[model samples]
Target: MGRILLPALTLICLIAARYLADQVGINGLPAPVGEWIDPLRLSEAAIWLCMAWVAKRAIEVALRRGRNGSDEERIPSIAFDFLGVLLFLVAIIAIAGLVFDQPVSGLLATSGILTGVVAFAVRDLIADIFTGIALAIERPIRIGDWIQFDEGTPQRTGRVVEMNWRAVRMVTVQGRTIVFPNNALSRRDFVNLSLPERHFRTVKRIVVDFSVPAERAADIIMSAIRATPGVVPSQKPLVLIDELVERGTVFSFHFWVPDYPKMFMIERQVVENVLHFLDQAGYAPSYPKLEADIAWQSVSEIDASFDLPDLLHRVPLFSKLSEEERLNLAHQSKEVQARAGQALVAEGDAGESLFVVLAGLAAVHKSVEGKLCRIGQVEPGQVFGEMSFLTGEPRSATVIAEIDSVFVEVERGAMQAIVRENPEIIDQMGEIQASRMNAQEIGDSTDGTRELDDPGFAEKLVKRIRLTFGQPG
Candidate 1:
């Protein structure tokens, strides 16, 4: 009803304007300076056309904002309507001037000279406008695109927020808005991170001491990445031995993420998971260690004794297990030893076991085209080989001992036996594993690390203990 009334009101205004214009005549005498400039020889039909043109333009603007139509359909229609308005006004004025015996040729010639001067003065502005038009047509960078400009020392990376006739605006990761001239952008080297696809590859580097073999570090990093959220397994990750630094070997793991907007969050998760895994595996990132001048004490003078049982009790996985359950699991878990430079597990090898590190450090590596590369290291208390154990598949990568290490090996049969003996334990384990696996499928790699600390698991374990003793769950 509003739309119909609007067009009706526009038609009435057009009729009034045209009626007044026809009364005044096309060659009317000039009025005083303060008087309004009245149209000469305006007709009802002409006035209606103008009113209809304006209404059409307003409707087009509303539709554009709604974003209901395709660019191909909407843009050209708007352009045509705009040009029609321009032509209508120009033709009306020229025709009126000619009907009144006024010289429009001279006016047009003067206007042309003025337009040329203005164009010359605003050459750069014109260039920017054309560039903007080109950008819109080519769509090198679209609205909401994540882009990085490689112009200066530190490249500017941001999400494109808006594009104007002369400039483009982007919001940086730090929440700063940057405006770049369209012409400048056209000439600059910029990468549309969200172009081609929304996915991007992010690389993380972990440097371990040279004493920790490179091959082992590579495997650890690769395994961590594969298990980490946001990493796409279809695009196999790469572990490159970047360089040999003075203190240690520097290695980088390059993995692909499907969403560029979530890159920062995913990278942080990967780093945290890698660090936690390395810490548990007894491997720490390499840094220069300070030497004390008075550190020549004999081996017999140093006390190395510590309570292993007390330390093990602090671990969350074992800490909550009942005494009998813990002892049972311990009995089923056999100690395996590996010396430095020894391969603990090889890539593409069959295994039906999982290892929990008890002491010492090991490196994880992956073989790419027959070349062994270091990814990262593992530390005590960390579990490895679970991938194959759970999936009943071959190992994707290899684990090698970086130092003389002791690890608790729980064979598949033993684990199955424990699960069968305690069905409740299996239920809890399944819940934890299922939740982590679901998160991985959705690219949330840190789900395993964070979700594993479920308080409900502890409560369930307590309830299970009570139930075994014929008490309430």
Candidate 2:
């Protein structure tokens, strides 16, 4: 109601001001030439004031509606801006005609001639003006869309910040605002990152010395990328050896990220992860000789070792056990190494052991008929074969070593012995097993046939329970 009344009040004030100006009589005041002041005519003032108010109201309403509605809603802003300018011009002409009492025919002729001359002189500017109107109507780029323009040489990549009649303003990655003429934008080849969808694929590449084996390099890089916090699993990050450069081998890390306004942050994170991983692996960016010498001296000769005492001391699962119990469990565990492309476990095979990866990467694949289909990959600090060990079920998937991998294998009998002695271990195992099973079930139910409740629903139920009983589940 207030929104509606404000424009009405503004119109009334404008009319009053115009009339009062015309009626003011200066009896004893000396006025300069061409400064004759008089209040506006009643009809003329009313029309002018009303037009101004209506134009202002239309602009406000259009902007509000545009923001609240779909992309199509923004079309009205262009109409409002054009009509508002037209109405304001009409009000000015009407008021001027009333003030001087001159015929409008002569004024129209003069204005039309001046407009034609201006248009002829500034054809490019006029084209840009019309192009801007077309841009507004078509909406090829919206506010906040990430776009790349002028692909050759030094490219201009930025997010659209504002659009106006003459030009579009883009805020670049370097924090500079560039104003490009609408006509120029229409002529250039531009890539709208926000078009069709608001998701984009970003590929980052890291060059590592060639001395690092291809398989080992890929494993380290992929593991680092997957472990990076902001990265999503759905994007399915891929690490490929793109090319062998003069100085080193280039590994292309490709993944999809949300097409956000500030994409430089994500790019920075990817680069940081790549550098961190290479540093951890003791590999330099350039020169194979240095990396080769370092690998040979520090890593190649290190014998396969699994510190049982350290594992029990670090892992939460074995933390509760006493030193003697940890030692006993460690004694039962065996260190196994599988070379690249080796199948550690086959689907439907009888498995009596659960493996905890200590280092290197493996993939979990299922044999559909005769061909192996990769379901997922496993990295360090992850465990597998728990389903077969706990339930004595057949191995659900084949675990294949993607790189030379090492793991600590605990036999079903040894795990059973440990759990039998410590019943608390069974409860902990049940919780872990339940979480994994739930995740697997959710992942496998792509056909919408599963009846499991969503986590959001469960969270709501838990919140209600907490509110009612003052305790949480």
Candidate 3:
């Protein structure tokens, strides 16, 4: 686009020089033509220099702010720069012939062999430069895009951090910068991971014995996926029966993540949550009698080290149930654990599981106007997540583990199973939920928090609980 300036500048200078020379007689020279021509040549060169200055400014402005902040229009503008330089070189040759009176035809004739040698020597370099120009124009992969390609090949992988005339630079996931020749990049196949929303789907497979009913096992896996923070909820997770083998059935979990960089961390959390859920369901890995105990506890399972039944007995609400019943409830529970400072239940997260704190301490906090205010402390045997667990609503507060903690989570199905047998447990659970609302000394009462014990609060709480738990009102 800026190439027009070079020709326009040259034409104007030519007309002005011709007018000056014709109007002011040249025959009044004091000395020889060549000696005096040097001074006149300098003056002509000064006029050409002024034109070059204008062309330079025009080219710079057009390249910089022309379109999309320059990057989108980088290719065309750069091509203009290349063409302008070539034209300037041609002008230099003309100036030499006109001002110094050199042989214009002989110079071109003698330079043919030299030009061929230079082209042959820099053939690859020239190809790479032109190839870079082509890529800049086409923009198959722009800067800031993530890509992957064959190792040691011309194709580059990772994020494109640099794009220039000779090469494309990428910073790989491993923290290495790779500079690929532009010509080489043109010859290879690469995957551009930035297209189509940049959402990456990952598949995780788990093997389980035939004893676990397919539907039941799938539910356990799906629950873990739903709890995972990285899983994109917009794309529903898929649980598929991938294969059946002598060992057991292979279940594949396919989930989409918004960011691909956090894939490994998300997968780790899913695997841990799934394994914990499986462990609580009596899939303790043991292999003493593989054939005989295949349907029940077998050698293939890892024994869940946490004593869930004993822990459940420690809770006052479960005190009415017998040891056998506690064990049954424990088996139905999904074991969940969290590290210090990790949230077992985040405020505003939709939850269906009632978390019974089995070990360690936790801090309960409510977000008031975007600021977290500590509401209470949860000791062992205390239950949280009950609001969302029984009501099918979001969590009322965030519970973070004060230390490495353990929890036996009873989801809606497991809670329903227990309530179907014992409806009285609902009243006791309701009383506790009511107590939390009415309690005066929940942590940080110094903020002068008002008691939430409104009239008919317990009735409303029990009503919602009974409805969600499938009890007759």
Candidate 4:
């Protein structure tokens, strides 16, 4: 606003001066002064030029507002600037024909040779500017969009940050800013990952041993990719045998993400989870052929450990259980797969079993002021429904699967038997439960609600547990 203030004020002053000169008959005042100035009509031309500048600034301001209205919408400033310059040229031509009574065609024709010489000398710069104008009009990509240039040995992907008459600037994943010449970009084909929509499918390839069945490998990898945190829940992930290689069978894992900028991070997470699941399934990647005899034990104790017992070990409430007890509990437990958006438990619903997340994400929502408000997220290795499991109470919050998730359900019978065998375990479990309650209390404090504190909450919880299980206090 400040930048345009001077130009606007100058225009107003020029108009007022011209009006006063006309009223006072200043055009006929003196011989030489009046004759020279009146014939050129310089005063009127100045007013026209000033008016054009003010109009251009106003148009640019409107363009800025339109660009800021949305994350995906963008309008290049250079396009408006070029239009403003063209406006100035038009105003100059109009003033020459109307005010000075000169022929506009002659003026333009006389400068044709000079324009040709300048164009020839700076042809590359002119091409860039014109290409930029074309791109600005077509708008294949916008600021903050992820785009790929498919010209090199390996394609380059980057987030566009700036665009102008000369170049388009973007920053790559490795944090390097590349200034792409507008003319070059215009000549080549590029892919806009953010166009059509932000969400798009991405794929990663893995090699598995030929000993592993193709269908089984695909199932395992698909599960792993679907359970990844950033995988779009609305789109189902896919896995297929892409090719057969000398080393093994090549499998392609396809998943969707909300945007392209985080593709690398999500791909890494998917790879890590896939490898973990593959290791747990006792299927490692194929090894290179060698002359020596290779002793490969495909089935190991680690593969056996991925059952309910392993998930129990991850929970702090069951961390103290002996391996034998864990195996016993595991025998009585069941592994369940939950589809994305499924509600596992609702607030105030009776549930005698607690679930431990083995993979994928879940969200905890509670009824607050008659509205379901998300309180927290439950990730892999975390536990939920324990409060209801321990005291035989109604569920305190609703747990919904944020993605395709796996969980191990520990039933009441198994828990009661383990607690009876290890009576002292009641106090340990109660303490952990109390700490969790206290954390919830702190979390709710911001909203003026308070829950039980840690001091006597554990003892009270232990008493409730004994009563719920029909055990002596």
The number of the candidate with the highest TM-score is 4
RMSD of each: 12.2, 12.9, 10.9, 6.5
lDDT of 1 by residue, 1-473 (tens): 35446656776777776666667764444677324543443443355455556656566567666765553223433233444566667655655474445587777787898999999999998888778777766778777778887642223888777777768888887788889988999998988888787787888887876544455466556556665667776787787999866656788889898866677787888788667656555467988757423333333332122223333343433454566666666566676877768988787789877677655566777776899877766565656665455445577667887655666776766555555566565445445444544444211111234344565654554454334334345
The residue-by-residue lDDT of candidate 2 on 265-322, one tens digit each, is: 7768777866665554444477545334333323342422324556544444455667
Error of 2 at 438 (Å): 28
The TM-score that candidate 3 achieves is 0.56
**On a 0 to 1 TM-score scale, where does candidate 2 land against the true structure?**
0.54
Candidate 3 lDDT, tens digit per residue, 45-85?
A: 55555555556656666655665554323443335556556
Better of 2 and 4 by lDDT: 4
Task: Name model 4 segments beyond 4 Å from true.
Answer: 1-6, 28-40, 62-71, 150-156, 208-223, 244-249, 276-473
Q: Model-by-model lDDT, in order?
A: 0.63, 0.65, 0.69, 0.77
Write down the TM-score of every candidate. 0.56, 0.54, 0.56, 0.65
Question: What's model 1's overall lDDT?
Answer: 0.63
- In angstroms, the error of model 2 at 202 is 1.4
Query: Which candidate comes out best when scored by lDDT?
Result: 4
Candidate 4 local distance difference test against the native:
0.77
Q: What range of 10 consecutive residues in model 4 has the weakest lDDT sum?
A: 441-450
The 10-residue segment of model 1 with minimum total lDDT is 441-450
Steric collisions counted per model: 19, 3, 9, 0
Q: How close is candidate 4 to the true structure, as a TM-score?
A: 0.65
